[model samples]
Target: MSEGSTGASVVPATVHLPDDRYIPVRTEDLVAALAREHDAFGELAPRLAHVGEALTRIVSAESGAFSRRIERAYAPFNPDRETVTVGDVGGDRAELAAILAYTFDKANYDLLEDTQVRAAIDSANVHGMKVRVDREKVEELQIFVRGRTQETRLVRTIRRPIVGEMREVELYRRLAVVFRMQNSVEVNIKLFRDIPVADLEALLPHAEAGMSNLDRIKILGGGIGAIGGATWKAAALLVSGTVIAGQYFWALIAGLVGLSVRSVLGYRRAKHLRSSQRTHHLYYQNIANNAGVLDLLVTSIGHEELKETLLAYALLLARGERIDGADALSRAVEAWIARRFHVTLDFDVADALESLDRLGLWADRATMRPLEPEPACARLEQHWRERTTEDYHARTLSQRG
Candidate 1:
């Protein structure tokens, strides 16, 4: 029952994924691409559409169930909830965290370890600001990121303190964080988009931003210049001897006091500017919060599940003889995506197989072959019928009781 420990169902480390688990193509687009590559897919296009629809329904059902589980677990900590519940708050909080971790995994997000978070803060980011997170104030913290892509960004150079455009800048397309404060047991959920990997520390709730080394140097140099100017003016006044002794003394005092005030004001202005920059960066990145975060996560889970299922089945049908096992199928899918969409990713073959197996489309487990498109569509329709019938009976029984 640690921070990220979910008892027997611990989430696996996804650090091996080069990009992310997300398939960067739409279902329809994927089908179209497959048809263009394989003539058989063009002939079975209608059946493939049917299979896609059926798989979507199944994934949607699973997503809805998981969403309910998350909402129930999160009820106690939901800040926007109107009702106050009287139960074991601690137990509810742990359950919420566990469900959220699972949801993040299902959504194909990679959990950021403490070490990784620290490393990101230690590294330089596009924004020239030093960020520090107060770990002592945090009772629990979990960060999950997904859709990592290399992008171009303007970053401050270390050698000359000049900004330049850097290519292949890694960034997380989506970021989700769960945080609980030491003083309060209530959990906080936050979701953001387009977070630079090096600036991940800035997303923390208790993160404090300070002026970078370059900014500090500028402030220090300005203060030194002000002092030098004040000293020169004082020396000039005394050397000229045009004013009386009391007048010269007051002039020196005024010059020193004004310099001190100017230095303080300059420091404050620089600090405020750094803080404003951090705020502006985050303002555009934040996407959702609290219950809204759960909704987005659930939706994402459904989308990822559907995409994986479609790709796996399509690959199996198109190249069933070539695929020897799950690994081979994964490679085939990955290669196809790289060739077609120009994106490389680590496909979650296990999850895809599980979905196909559940839908009864997986014909041979040993060979990793799926049923033909026409038969697969029929089987999925039958499965959907059974599911709907079971739901109808369950609802009927509940209403009667």
Candidate 2:
């Protein structure tokens, strides 16, 4: 209860990832859960239903950009020339795409140029052939895309760390702590349970957050290779072959080196990536449950317009920290919510405070102080130190070593 810091952010002696720590978030389960919330939609119910339906369609869609690329760009480069293999017709979409890419790379690099690869590409380019993808492969790719996209959407809508109006240095310190936690026990459920309920209570915004940074890196690597190769070929073609020795050689070498560095960076960036599907699923379910609680709080003590604002404040209060005294905190939270969700909502502080008081989130009658984490939440944080993934991996490695 002291005003001082929480003991310089102690680093645990060990970290451990639970053996069954991550469970895959099944897309079907998410759909089922979303479907259950349909009747609870009220005025926005129809719109929500439409989004869910769109999700279904997207996940079920057969071909993707990669699939189309395989069909359009490389399918004609098939070596056999026995039949016109449009897209992934031979059930080797992935391999064929890779080979086609390698062929293009060889053309640009002019290194170990395979005669057969050149012949195939030249044939395809002239013949104007397209590729066909296997139905099963297309389905697999779709599912992967859907899973990645949904997790991205969930994080975009939620998973934000809310900050109080502390000093700039203090704010950076808090953010540093958040970054560290994100790397360590943030993956664990105990730590998740320890997160302030208020942050979790805002529910998800409708928009999808787009592909994650890691996924974007993967795309970047491929894009660089493809674009760089094409650029080199185009530039070389513009110059005469008689003068190709000086300018062409230097350009090709420099471009290849640049492409190699980017590819390595993208690959290295990918190594630190951890899938958040399980965490997103857990948070998704939490949002649904919290929605019911917020609804009850609204019905009991809040106005129709004040429902979301009250919910946000209640979450902040229950989250185990006070931003300001009751009156000031209430006003600040209302203003922030109005601005944060301005397009979708209007703000109301009076009813929101009343709701918070009714819900026991208000610290005391007069001062309206912030409440500390519940005993259960404190216990969860304590438990995380003893059950960290770092400890688990260390022990396993020691045994194996």
Candidate 3:
């Protein structure tokens, strides 16, 4: 099998690639591998190409040799030996969330046949209580546990990602309707790289609508005519030249060929777009197990679309905060506030902001002003310190023994 590009001993698996050769894959490829076929790990590769320069630098370090080369970056990805923990603010939360959520939501929930989120949501609603989570810890996990619903003695946490800016609320709403599944599931994607709460929430509505349309226009659902035309053009090009010039018949062929080329290109664009939506879909479906009565509650209020929109928006709002009151109320509160005052608050609220804080709902602190993001993130200035001090000391002790 292909060796890990990061030079660590490869995980035991069977494949046809050379024992020493590494096959790096795009992050998207890893995601697709899991969604399409979980066991098809051999096909997925780390998106290590961009990091080639970084890897080369590490390999050249005096402490770094062939043994430690590719594995440096790979260390973050290994669950068994984590370089960062939930308490480590600088831990690659987004990637960790993506991989783990898929396991929890898909493998544990769907494929493995464990928790049924729809049922969990219901049980939690009936007997659920809310918990108050630490602000700094929430940043560590990149999730604000809005609230929880206890069912079968299990606390099912409900939450939403905070969209830093209020203006993106509309987008969050749209995303809820189109891609609300992300919220409904159990995977906590603390955050996407550089996709702040505001941008996601702002673009949510459009993203949702567009994704929904895209699904219909591609994948399992789509506009058949558009897709079919593209496929035909692609096929024709594969067999012949981009431009066919010759007989009168060739001129006629040219017209068809033009359509074919355009169609294939369109199909590819649609396919690429479709890939991201699948992640959102599978991700949400996994976490939604405990959305609580929100889904039914919204439906009862005759606001199914609104409710869906709210779910995605809600997750966007509570991304980096902590709300641990028995259930999803904190997250719900965050949603209500966004819907009401259109602002986000931090955990360190003064007594004066009480009414303003509670009026919005959820476990939020009072904002200094609208549009300014509270320092919800847990700073990781000590990451390298901990790496070199704590971990390195432990490694030394272990080796000495």
Identify the candidate with maximal TM-score: 1
The parts of candidate 1 lying over 4 Å away from their true place are 1-19, 35-37, 40-42, 83-91, 124-126, 158-163, 235-243, 388-401
Weakest 10 consecutive residues, lDDT, candidate 2?
142-151
lDDT of 3 by residue, 137-247 (tens): 222221212211111211112221122111111011111111212322222222112121112222221222122232334543333455466556656665665444223
Candidate 1, residue 215: the lDDT equals 73
Per-candidate Cα lDDT values, in order, are 0.72, 0.30, 0.27
Error of 3 at 233 (Å): 18
Q: Taking the tens digit of each residue's C-alpha lDDT, what string does model 1 give over 1-401?
A: 01221111111232232348877677668755665654545565556766787777776666676667677778877778887767665455545655776778877888877777665555533366777778899988888888877676554454334643343456678888888889886788899997766677788878877877767778878878877876877777778777574587687788778877887888889888888888998999999999999899888777888789888888788778888887898998898889879998899998888778667786777777788877887887787666743232124224544
Model 3 regions more than 4 Å off: 1-115, 118-211, 214-247, 273-401
- Once model 2 is optimally superposed onto the true structure by TM-score, how far is the C-alpha of residue 97 displaced, in angstroms? 58
Q: Is candidate 1 or 2 superior in TM-score?
A: 1
For model 1, what is the error of residue 88's alpha carbon versus the real structure, in angstroms, after optimal superposition?
6.6
In model 3, state the lDDT of residue 393. Answer: 17
- What's each prediction's TM-score? 0.84, 0.18, 0.20
User: In candidate 2, residue 189 scores what lDDT?
Assistant: 9
The candidates, ranked best first by lDDT, are: 1, 2, 3
